[model samples]
Target: MAITSANQLELLQTAEAVAREKMIDPGLVVEAMEESLARAAKSRYGSEMDIRVSIDRKTGRATFTRVRTVVEEEELENYQSELTVEQAKQYMADPAVGDTYVEEIPPVEMGRIAAQSAKQVILQKVREAERDRQYEEFKDRAGTIINGLVKREEYGNVIVDLGAGEAILRRNEKIGREAYRPNDRIRCYIKDVRREQRGPQIFLSRTAPEFMAELFKMEVPEIYDGIIEIKAVARDPGSRAKIAVISYDGSIDPVGACVGMRGSRVQAVVNELQGEKIDIIPWNEDQPTFLVNALQPAEVSKVVLDDEAGKIEVVVPEEQLSLAIGRRGQNVRLASQLTKLDIDIMTEAEESARRQKEFEARTALFMSTLDLDEFFAQLLVSEGFSSLEEVAYVEIDELLVIDGVDEGTASELQARARDYLEAQAKAALDAAREMGVEENLIAFEGLTPQMVEALAKDDVKTLEDFATCADWELAGGWTTVDGQRVKDDGVLEPFGISLEEAQDMVMTARIVLGWVDPEELASAEEDETADEEDEA
Candidate 1:
């Protein structure tokens, strides 16, 4: 082969073009190409059975060559194929049968093949290096918004130039209410950055809910300063968004502050969000009230919470139901998501019906004493003791201990209880007479005239009737002849007996009667007994 001046110039030009295309140093390409050609040449005629072609990158010169082992007999077709050890020793001072001897062959064409293979390897490496570089650049940018130039649209997505790389803005990520033009500057969230065959592929979005949140951060000085915080946010992108905000200082009205004076601040955020409507609600610690406010423009009459279910039923006027639910259920849906509640909306009328049912159920618990004073009825309700049985079974002293009761009332209540029991006993006795137990004795001997007078006021007559009385209802939990507790610190203050004396007398009466329940005795003993003993 002949090396021509024109051929050398052409190869030089080809090397420069290939290096430029692959972004590599032209000198490295030339070195690699020359090394590969030399190895090919050795493969073509080396001791084993073939010869090869070679190239000189610097000189544009090329050749073919064969290599063979020195052998005993030169029986092979070419001298390069084999040589006798004795004969090889003449050409080489120390030649062995297995040793390879290189034989230079006539020149050959290899410049084109070497150049093509070199270009392929260079391009593949360049592509991989580019991918790695791009991945490193964008991975740290996730969760932040970046500005990108609109490059072109492929299929339905817009390819964006992000400085050193490109990102894809899919149709779903685009603000549906807005359009983009070529070369337009746009802000998009770096939703994700992933490695791909071409390079690091970035996914961008303009309609993510965080888009509005980011815009708020950018617009609000208070938010940036951390004086106000965004508790939660929900969006119907391209249409509306709801954000619950809280201020660390009570002096700051979170909603008003976020909205800015006359809507200036919020409008700026809205503009950035492509005019998406923003409702800034003040965050509340009270869940019911917070939820009520989250469904704004709708006045809430009440919020009923079912703690076990984490559900809230809100009662609003009929007119506000639509407002509460929003357009196409967007308002309530966002409210539920923002507050993490399953919200049910009801009208005032419906709530009234439910409350009435509760009241009726409470009323049904009383047996015969439904005609009690309305104030007493309200007291029962306030104490959360809504049933007659609860008031009936409570002891007189315990009833007086309730928040609003007093001792004097508790004593009067005890007397009434005795009378009511006596009435029941009489009724039972009548039933017994019609059936049988008429032999039972009625004993008023131990009772004082004052005690008898107190029961007579309520119309009590018999012991059988007294046994059926509810002490708490009659005594109001405080027993008093005047306006004092019957037993003040285990003593009768009027009689000047320490608690010990009252205890002894009551025990004496219980032992003497053998049938008296001490708690049922009106007094330890009548004053007449003391008067008679003093006279004796």
Candidate 2:
């Protein structure tokens, strides 16, 4: 049936109504209609023809046309979509390349099947428009709190109705021991918004630390006003949580402000979180002081930091040990998370015992390695001499500063230290050769005798193995294991070679072995060219 003027007006009204109901642009609905009509026309006018359709926004009048671009004879690619300038001259007096020509085609009568196909097209477009609107609306709202009703439960996950759309609260993100029935009103943090195959997925979470921080913001006026800022949060959800807060105004106590008068503000947050305990602590610029504060109520006797290893050792009184560690190590675990440091907690007695053991081990090492008496070894250990390398590198004056040590004795000790190290190196080299290490690798500039032995033990006995070793294997960066990058001990660490020297040695070995090829040279040339172009 042909769509008459009367039906065309009805079509426009229907599109407007659908757009209003679906919250999509009316223009998009009209475009969908035009595309549907064009697809239907292709059945009558040959699929190879470049057919198109357009609908007037106000009148709902649809137009069908054949479209082609005028191109030079040599530039023509498709006969249906492009026309030569001479061929296009029939449609327009003067036709040139890049000129578009549109010829109108009479409206075709629509059959029942064609009308149904058109309706399906319109429905799909409206669905896509709705999905796009939902994605745009919620994508920027991530990291914010949203109120919704629990619509239903799927498996262990909760489906939330957010008025405009639906969201999902995954099972792992729900607070422990918390359950909701249908129509229960709940507030959750929007963790993420993703566009999936089905539709936009808005992920909600009740156990994110940021969710707790946001709840505090709602409860504490000072926090909302920026007078108090939540610096960091760590949560063992539904059990306990700690928040570090700092105050911009000195007069305003950040913790007290968050606590509110009579603990009302914090209590509100606790109530919302199903009676979870909250500890609000003051933030400190110094890390050790901050860590001390983070582990509150448990007294700390001392804090020893290993900055290079990114770890902290905290010692507490024996009585406070269990309190500091908490049940199953929860307290120290939360403290580590809050401070972003690896923490090791011990009692004062344990720390003292460990220190004494280390001292004895170092003394024994000095005595046996340098052939010194127990008294002399004790003296060297007390003066902070832990290894033979330190003894060999220290100035003679430094050794003379030790008690009962004079100039002659210091010189003899230094000579003995040097001779011992030389003999040790020779022994390592002999062992490496016995293990069948390549002569070329043994002669490498940066590979000390001990390093050769280590490599040989690992079966990296050939120059090819040395050349193919990753930078981390040689100079120590990181290595991928099970798809995660972990710190590499490096072959050089045992040999006492600096990472810089290892890197230089690796480069020199690769050049000497000719591992680099012409492809690598070409890549280098391309990089230089790109740099010059960027500079120009």
Candidate 3:
């Protein structure tokens, strides 16, 4: 095709049509055309001749030019694209080393091959621009619901056609075995929007907890407004779900508002979820109170919380145990997800037996360690003295508070407990030394003789070993594996060392061993303080 033979204004018209069809800027289409034309010009001229093209925005007249950069004699590498100062002097009166010399050139009359190449370039650029437009339009819409037509299904994954672009709802993200036919209307949450080599990929989800939250937001005006808020949501996809909500306006009950006047709001969400049963509970700041509320339809006799482990124990009546746990532990699992805590539910009878077992264990420990009879050891255990260390170090007045325990009897108990502890410590110290424990570690503050022995057994015999250990390695923590909390045993965990205390001890060891710069720590601490103050 002859470039000059065609109507010049056709360039602008074509650009406008492509831009409108692709929903992109017309200027971008013009730029792509200019680039394609330049490539064709380079093919006609020398490929290394530095050819460039510019089309006038209004007239659509294509202007081609060759650019040659001025450089020093030693730096002139590309003879076709660059020129030395001496060579450029003929083009300019006074050419500098960095100046470029652009000269006008005739436009190429593209052949069939060149024209096809240009067409390919234009299509590629238009596709890219379209993908970018689709991504920009849908990125901010994530976490919200959108309606689309089901385009097709690929390996159980449904592809939905939004008016602007296509989105994918993976099989695992669909609510149970929900199937869709071509052109069927479907609503989904925009889970994510990602840019890929082919185009922007919009991921849709129907089983996400956020999907339920968004559905409620659309159905409940109070949630859409600032009057009520959805605090947490847990779902079993098509089977069942739970949602906790709170209200800012005291007059508006959050759960009741969400439930609606005739169960309309919650029912709407339930219908969308394929008849998934929902348990709506009120949000509470107190975790125990919240758990009690979360485990609805079953009365909780007692609640015990282990804050450090992020676990809770719930005691219910014998008859209510199965109801509390729900079908196949689904109820408790959803409650655990909602509260962000691991729950162990048992009957009130089981709880009483467990308490009795613990009391017996403590009583036996006191009887064997302090050389006291059953009655006296039980008395000490009943007084809340669980360990020999507590009995040895507690104030004399606390021991005197126990029945039939005067100052003399308290002194005798203290002497026995200390003697036993000291003897145990001596034996542990000997064992640690036998295991290559160093004096530096023994002299280190905070760690007891038994702790040292434990560290030695764990291969942390030197102060350097302690400094190199991670906080979680020295203080036990819970790990979630396959959605179950597993206990990680730490060397110092038996001594009741917390994560914070382990961190402090490690930092102190590092400082004492000259492994850490105290001044740098101080500087970092000051920076953190400044950041907190600024946030406040």
Candidate 4:
């Protein structure tokens, strides 16, 4: 192909055709053509020479040029492309270093080998531009639902064609063992769009909980219009799922709106999910109330929530135990996910038995430690005194409130409890010292002797070690693993240390060790208080 040929307009026409076919900017294709022409010119006119090409956008006229750049004497390296200031006087009267000298050069005729190389360069550039376009188009569409056609199956993975790009639905991301043949229509959630070496990798998921939420958004006009919001969703993909929704408007019922008339809206989502059952529950600001709603078709007699531990215990009638738990613990598991809390469901009789056991344990503690008769210990336990610390430190008025308890009896009871606690603390302190606990840790203001011993047992002997510990490490916490909540035992958890108390104690230790500035802590507290005030 020669630039001097009468078919020069064919270059611009071809660029336009390629750009249109690939849905890319025509200017990109023209730039690729220019690059290929330059590469081809470099091959013909000594590969060392600096060759450049430019084409007129309207006339399709290809212009070839030879460029030489002036440089410093010591910096001149390429003899063909660069020239020193002293040797550049031949090109111009006053040539300066770092200046380019250009002259028009006749375009060369591309041979078979050169034509093939040029074609390859242009194709490479076009492919890169197409990849960039595809990534840009789909990156913003992540976390959304998409409709596509199954292109093929490779190693149990389904490749879906989205018209512009292909997405991979990994086997684990598929709903159950659903199969798809070529050209099968499919809908999936665009979980992610990642730019990789070969191209953009679009990951699609049919089992994502968000996919159910998106489907409901499409089916419910109220949700799409912002009147109703899906608060949470949990799925056992292709088996069963639970969704909690809230309504901003007073007139609209979120659950009813999601269910639609005659179960039409939810049924549509269920069909897409391969007949997965869905429980639509109304969202509540009160966590316990919302949890009650989440465990549907089962009656809950009472709910006991341990907020700090993020755990809830539900008491139901004996007959409702199986219903509340569902088949293979599915119902309670879904409820736990929807509520973001670990739930323990038990029958009313079981709860009663557990309460009785606790009462006996507290009674035994008082009997053994305070030397109290069974009747007095039971009375104290019934009046909500469960620990020696509470008995020793509680107001005299609290003890007087119990029948047959006078000031003399209260004083003796408190004295006995205090003596027992002092003995336990002394023993714990001695044990901690034997384990090499430092004086600074024992003298810390907030930590009790039992807590110090626990810390020493865990190898946190010094104040520095205490300062290095995380709040969760001292107060226990819940971790999400494999979509299930797992318990992490903390050294001070048995001491009934709450997360906030643990945090405060650790920060105090840090300040005492000069590791944290008191002024910064004060400033942070002020800022937090101000934020809370602003929110209120």
Which predicted model would earn the best TM-score? 3
lDDT of 1: 0.68
Alpha carbon lDDT of residue 311, candidate 3? 91
Tens-place lDDT per residue, model 4, 1-536, is: 89864767889999999999999999999999898999999999989999999999998999999999999989989999999888889887799988898999999899999899989988999999999999999999999999999999999899999999999999999987699999999999999999997999999999999999999999999999999999999999999999999999999989889988999998999898999999999999999999999999898999999998789999999999999999999999899989989898888888899999999999999999988889989999999998999999999999999999999999999999899999999999999999999999999998899989999989999999999999999999988899777899999999888899999999998898898999998999999999999999
Per-prediction tally of clashes: 32, 0, 0, 0
Q: What are the clashing pairs of model 3? A: none
Each candidate structure's TM-score, on Cα atoms with residue i matched to residue i, is 0.52, 0.84, 0.97, 0.94
Cα miss at 533, model 4 (Å)? 10
Error of 1 at 7 (Å): 15
For model 2 the local lDDT of residue 180 reads 96
Off by over 4 Å in 2: 43-50, 67-101, 221-228, 433-447, 460-467, 474-489, 495-536
Off by over 4 Å in 4: 434-436, 520-536
True-vs-predicted CA distance for residue 226, candidate 4, Å: 0.8
Candidate models: Cα lDDT each: 0.68, 0.88, 0.93, 0.93
| Backbone collision tally, model 2 | 0
Cα-lDDT of candidate 4: 0.93
lDDT of 1 at 240: 86
